[model samples]
Target: MVDRRVHEGEAVIERAVVDGRPVDADARLALDARYGHFTALQVRARRVRGLDLHVERLQSANRELFGAELPRPEVLGAIRAVLGDDLRDASVRVYVVAGDRPRVLATAAPPTEAPTGPWSVTPVVYQRYLAHVKQAYGFQQAHIGRQVARAGFDEALLTTEDGLISEGSITNLGAFDGERLLWPDAPMLHGITMRLMERMDVPQERRPLRAADLPRLGQVFLCNSWGLMPVGRVDDVPLRQDGKLMTRLHEHYDAVSWDPLD
Candidate 1:
C-alpha cells in the first residue's frame, strides 16, 4: 500500500494512491484541472453496498468524459492496494484523473460517521455543471453552503431558476407524505442510498417536486451515505421532525445486504 501511515501507532489513512504510485496530490490533481470522476462509498469488510452500481458509475463517467474504458479489474487492483490486507471497515473513494492516459486514485479513511442532523437548510437557485457525475464539483457546493451558513442555515437546498426542487448540496432530498416516500425527479445525482431505498420495502415514488410542496409534505428527510436525517427547517418554514421515522428508515437500510469485495 501507499506509505500513508502516520501518528504514534502508525495508523494508515490511505488516500491519493495513483496507479500503484504514491503521488503528490497537489501536483497530480492540479487544483481540479486534472480531476475527472469519482465514487464515494462506505466499505465494510473490504466490501461495499451496491458495489456494482459504484463500478458502473465510474465506467459511465469515464465513457462520457474521456470515451475510454475504466475496467473494474484495474480499479479493483488500485482499491486493494489502498485497503491492503485486512481492513474491517473504511470509507473509500475511487477517482479517475483525466489525461492522455487516465489514472486511478484510491482514497481511504476511517469510515465516515453520521453527522448530527435535523439540519437547517435554505433553498438556493443553483445546479451542478455535471450533476450526474460524482466529480470534483465540491467547490460550487461549498460556496453555496457557506452562503447558506451565513444566513444561519446548515445546508443549501439546490433549486432550479423557477423554484423547482432538485437536491441538497451533498445529499438526496426525500419527503414523507404521511404515506409514501417522495423523491424529487429533477436533475440531480441519483445517490446509491436512494437507489437502494427504492428497492427496499418502502412506499416511494419518483416525481416532479416543487419547492412549494415542502409545506404540504408531512415530513422531510435527507438521505445519503452518512444516513437518514430529518429536515427540521426549510428556510423559515419548520417541517415535522419524526425521530421514529428516521429510526425505521435506518433499520430498513441496515437490513440491506452488504456486498463483499472478494
Candidate 2:
C-alpha cells in the first residue's frame, strides 16, 4: 500500500510521487507546469478502461516532445505506485518532463463528478499547437473555458481559421446525424475514450464540420476520458439531446473491460 494522507479543507486532494519518491506540493506543481506531456484518466477499484491506449499516448507524446522513449513497464509501475490500493474511484495524471535527466510524475485524487450537461457552448477561433500531442496547455484551455463561462456557456468549442469546428477546450466533439457519428477532420487529440468508442464498432466518419453545419446535425455530444455527455446548444443554436444516442454510447462505454492498474 502507498501512503495516503489528507490536507484539511481540501475538496480534491492529490498525492504525487516523482520517480519513486513522494514530492512536496511545490515540486509537484513545478513539474506539472513545466514543459512536459501528460495523460489523465479515471481509475475505479484500481482498474482503468483503455489502459493500453493511455500508455501508448504517453509514449507517443514523450517521443514527439522529448525525443525519448518511455518504457511501458516503467510507466505502468509509476501509475500503480501512485494509485496503490486506495482507489475507490479516482482521477490519475501521468506527467513526463524532458531534461538532462527525465522525470516522471504521477498524481491521483478522488474523481470529480462527471458534468451533467445539456451543455451550451460558444465557438472560439483558435487551434492548438502540435494538436496531436497532449502537452501542458492548461493555461490557454482554462482561459477560454473561463471566458465561455462568463458568457453563460458551459464550455468553448475551438474552431480553425476557416470556421470549421474542431474540438472543445478539454472535450472532443462528436456529431450524430441520425444514421452515423461524425468526427471533425481537423488536428485534434484523439482521446482514448473516442478510440474506445470506435473500437466498439460505433459507426463514425471523419470530415470537416463547419459552423453552418451545426443546425443540420441531428445531435451533438462531448466526450473525454471521464465519459460521454450530451450537448444542447452551440452558440445560439439549440441541438437535440438524443436520448437514444446517449443510451447507446453509455452502454458501449460501460461494456469496455477494465485493466488493473498494474
Candidate 3:
C-alpha cells in the first residue's frame, strides 16, 4: 500500500549526500532531541487503523522499555503534520539512534498487500534482545528480505530461539495445526495488528512449533499492523495456493470492528 509519491521522495533523499565531517556535541544533542531516545518508531499503515492506537502502543512500549512514561514526543504529531493531506492509507517509520542526540526519520508509505500463494520461509534462530520493543532493529529483516529475494520467495518467517515460529520480518506468524490457529506462546513481542485480530475473537493458540511440524500445517500466513498476508510458498515446499482460509480470515479482519486494549 506504499504511496507512489512517498517512494519517490525516499529515492530522492537516498541519492542526496551532505559534505561535512559531522557536527559537534551541542549540535548533536540538538539533533537527537528532535527524534527522542528510541532507535526507531513505527506506526502501522492499516492495522491499528487510527492515530490513537499508534500513540497508545508507543506509550506502552516506552514504559516497558524505559521504566518511565513516554514524554509525548512530538514525533507522532510531526508524522501526522507532515503527511497531512497526502496520507490516507500508509504506514510510518521513524528511526532515532542514540548519540550526542537522537536522529529521527519519518516515512508514511502504503501497506503491504496479501500474498497470492502458499509460502516457504527460513526462521532466524536467535532473538533481538529488545523483541518487546518496536524500534528500528531491522537488520534481521533486511537480511531475510535479501535471502527471500535471492531464493525467489515472498518473505521471511522467523521462529523464536525455542523453535516456535514467532513472526515474520515485518509481520507476526500464524499457522493452523490441524485443530486451531497456533501462535507462538512465550515471552515474545505482541504486535498491535495481531492483538486487534485476537480481540475480534480469532481463535489462536500459543505453542512451540518445530521444524518437523511444518508438514502438518493446514494453512500459514503473516500478520502485522498492516494486515494478514497469505504465504504463497515456503523454502522449497509449497502449500495450496487458492488460499481460501487465509482469504476469509483476511476479509473478516477487514470488516470487523476494533478498540485498542493496550
Candidate 4:
C-alpha cells in the first residue's frame, strides 16, 4: 500500500491527491497499481519551468490513451488549490486513469539538486511502449533500475535492440562532442528541460548514438524537468568531464523563465 504520509527528515507531508481530493493509503495504492498517464514537474515559489509544455504533454497523452481531451485549466486550478497558500518547493505529479478523470498529486519537498558528482550507468536493452507518452506504468524501468543499483551502478540506461542508446529509465540522455550536444535519434520521451534547452539555442543534433560512440564522446549528461545532470560513466568505461560545456548548458537552462501557477 502507498503510505499516506511521506516522511522527509522531520516533516510529515501529504503526498497524494485524486481529482482534487486527498487520498488515503488505500486509495493511493489502488491508483498506484492502475495503468495511467502522468507528467512530473518541480514547482518552486508557485512556479514551474515549461509549464505549457507539461500541460500539452498531459493533454496529448490523455487524448492518445483515453480518446478524451484533458481540460488544462481545470488541472492547473486543481494543482493551485492543492498547493494553496503554501507555494514552497514541491514535486507535482498529474495522473490520468482510464475510467476516472485526471488527478493531480503533490508532495512538499525541496527541488532536486543537480548532480555534483558523476553517475555510473549500466546499459539495459529494453524499449517502452508508446515511447512518447509519460505513462504511470514504469514497472520495467523500476525493476531494471533496482537491479542496476544492486550491481553497483547508479542508474539503468535503456538501449534499442540493436545497441543504440535510447534514454535513461527515468531521464533523457544527451552526449557532448566537445563542441555540440547530440541527442539519440530514437523513440523516447522528449523531456521538457531538453526542449527548453533546444529553444534556448543550444547547438544540438539528433542522430543514432550507439554503444561504440560512447568512447569518442567527450561528455554525457542526463536531463528532465527537474534539471540537467552530468553522467560520469557508462558501464565500466569512464567518460570525460567537460566543465565548460556543463556551465554553458546550465546558463541557458537557468535562463528559462518560470511561470507562476497562481
Decide which is better by lDDT, 3 or 4: 4
For model 1, the stretches where C-alpha displacement exceeds 4 angstroms are: 1-14, 25-32
Best candidate, lDDT-wise?
Answer: 2
Q: Tell me the tens digit of each residue's lDDT in model 3 across 2-110.
A: 2223212222221110111223445533443342323112234323353454566666665664454544455454455434544444445543444443333444445
Per-residue error at 199 for model 3, in Å? 2.1
Across residues 1-262, which tens digit of lDDT does each residue of candidate 4 receive? Answer: 1011211111244455667776776776677667778777788888889999989998888878778788878678657755767656777767777445545544344455555577778789999998998878577776776677778776677898889888888788887776678999999999888788777565679999876687688888888765888888777888889898888888988898999887
Give the Å shift of residue 199 in candidate 4.
Answer: 1.5
Q: Candidate 2 residues 1-262, lDDT tens each?
A: 1011111112354678888578888887677557888888888887889999999999998888888889998888888878766665778888897555678888887775456768787889989988888876367876777677778877778998888888888889988777688999999989998888886565679999976787788788888876887888888888877788788778988999999865
For all predictions, the C-alpha RMSD in Å is 5.4, 4.9, 6.7, 4.0
Lowest lDDT sum, 10 consecutive residues, model 4, at: 1-10
Q: Please give each candidate's TM-score.
A: 0.87, 0.91, 0.69, 0.90
lDDT tens digits, residues 120-233, model 1?
777899998888887653667767766776678767789999888889887899987766889998899988888877775767888887766787777788877766767887
Instruction: State the RMSD for candidate 3.
Output: 6.7
Which segments of model 3 are wrong by more than 4 Å?
Answer: 1-51, 66-68, 71-76, 94-105, 110-112, 160-162, 177-179, 240-242, 257-262
Q: How accurate is candidate 4 locally (lDDT)?
A: 0.74
